[model samples]
Target: MKSTLRSELYKALTNKMLYIAIAIGLAFWAMDVMENQEKIKFFDETLQWAVNSGLPIGTGHEGYSLFFLWSGLAPQTKGANLFYTVWPVFAAMAYGWSYSDERRSGVYNQIAARTSAMRYYISKYIAVFVSGGLAVAVPVLLGLLANAMFVPYAQVVQGLGAVTNINFLSELYYTAPWAYGLIWCGVTFLCGGTAACLCFVVGTSLRYSVMVILTPYAMFVAIDALTNSLRASILKNVRLILSPLRLVWSSPGWANPEWWVFLMLALLTIFSFGIGYWQVVKHELA
Candidate 1:
């Protein structure tokens, strides 16, 4: 089982599209960092515009003491925002292809002849999980690197401590490139893995495979569109980036979710894998 799983994993790793998407993400992050001139301008202009226009400088609609800074290069932040937004879909599609192709081409039957369906399914999950993680992380890490260098400019002008406290330890621990990257990547990985597992369930239970793959992502998007303001607090601490990404710019960037939110995320992760495992064990792999 281990050898069979390993071989299957090795095959999944060779996908060119997966690597290409990751490369593009990294390139965008690098470019965003290298060009910080606009980010500074946006930050300055937005704050001034807000104050001049008589809007509260750093508060939410409810008049909560929220510090909202508009960086000149909203595009860079938007890029980071979009990067996390679209990455999970890339992961789901890439990993989904692993099984989709096998099922479509009838290659799965050949594999099932020698290995258990469970082995194949589990192996696919492991391989694709790693791929999804990299899809989210590579670019985020690059962005973090860019922020580490060019971010100083953003801090200096914005009065780094004015909007929010930037303790060196906090940056080192939670807001640092690696730490923030991991948190964001974890969000994408879970979302992607959940999407992939749902696809697998759909593959075995239904004929049309696209529904299983696209439904989860589509559901959240629709909800976000419908519920803009309420979603900010709901998704703010979900650790599920889908929830937060929906309102990232609207809400405070560093909003720490309640502990219960993390617990819920953990539960959801386990539930997704558990469901996938159950389906794999019973799934008819032809």
Candidate 2:
């Protein structure tokens, strides 16, 4: 299993389309930051949209503005949970190509005949996560670097819409803090991995690979829109799509999330892995 997993990881990393797509994403991200240097115009629009979407507009509160800024800007940031879309899309494409092509070429059955099906499944699962992580990490690091050096991090950090006299470290540490940034990035990774794993299951069954690739993303969008239609009171009390990103608004008196929510999510990931393994182990009618 370990050897197979390592080999699969290598194949995933060497995928030509994945490499090209990452290069294109990096180029676009660089251009976006440079053109919007010192102040991204979209930050303000994002803030207004949050207000319109029912984020509380507290007056005379010192923390409210900062809270609003984080809530709004996070969605557009490359490393954020809301941007999990970027990670999963490429992951699904790359993994789908790997899985579907090999099966079509009879390489899958050949491998299964030699290796345990469980090993093959585990190898693919690990490879998919590695591929998804790289898809997210490369562009994210570039965006963070560009934001720190060229773009006015202070303006974005402070929601001020103007560059201020703040060092990059202070902008990063004091404004949002590195700990918070790490958590947000972690959320993005997990969400992306979750979506990719789900899509891997679909790819094993779907006729058109694109349909499998897009399923997770479509579900997220559909769930997000559905959550928006619910009452604000209900939405705030519950965790839903991008709900962790919405934690910038968790009321002071509200109860902390039950431990069960975390447990349930962990179980979900485990279950998904099992499903992916099962699919690979069974003979397909194709």
Off by over 4 Å in 1: 34-37, 40-76, 153-198, 204-213, 226-261
**For this target, which candidate reaches the highest lDDT against the unseen true structure?**
2
TM-score of each: 0.64, 0.66
lDDT of 1 at 191: 45
lDDT of 2 at 20: 68
lDDT of 2 by residue, 14-93 (tens): 98766865675566556545544423445555567877889886323233222222321343333333333354565456
lDDT of 1: 0.51
| Model 1 agreement with the true structure over 55-160: per-residue lDDT tens digits | 9666222111111112111233455555545554555555555666577778878887788777777787677666655654556545655555534322222333
- As a TM-score, model 1 comes out at 0.64
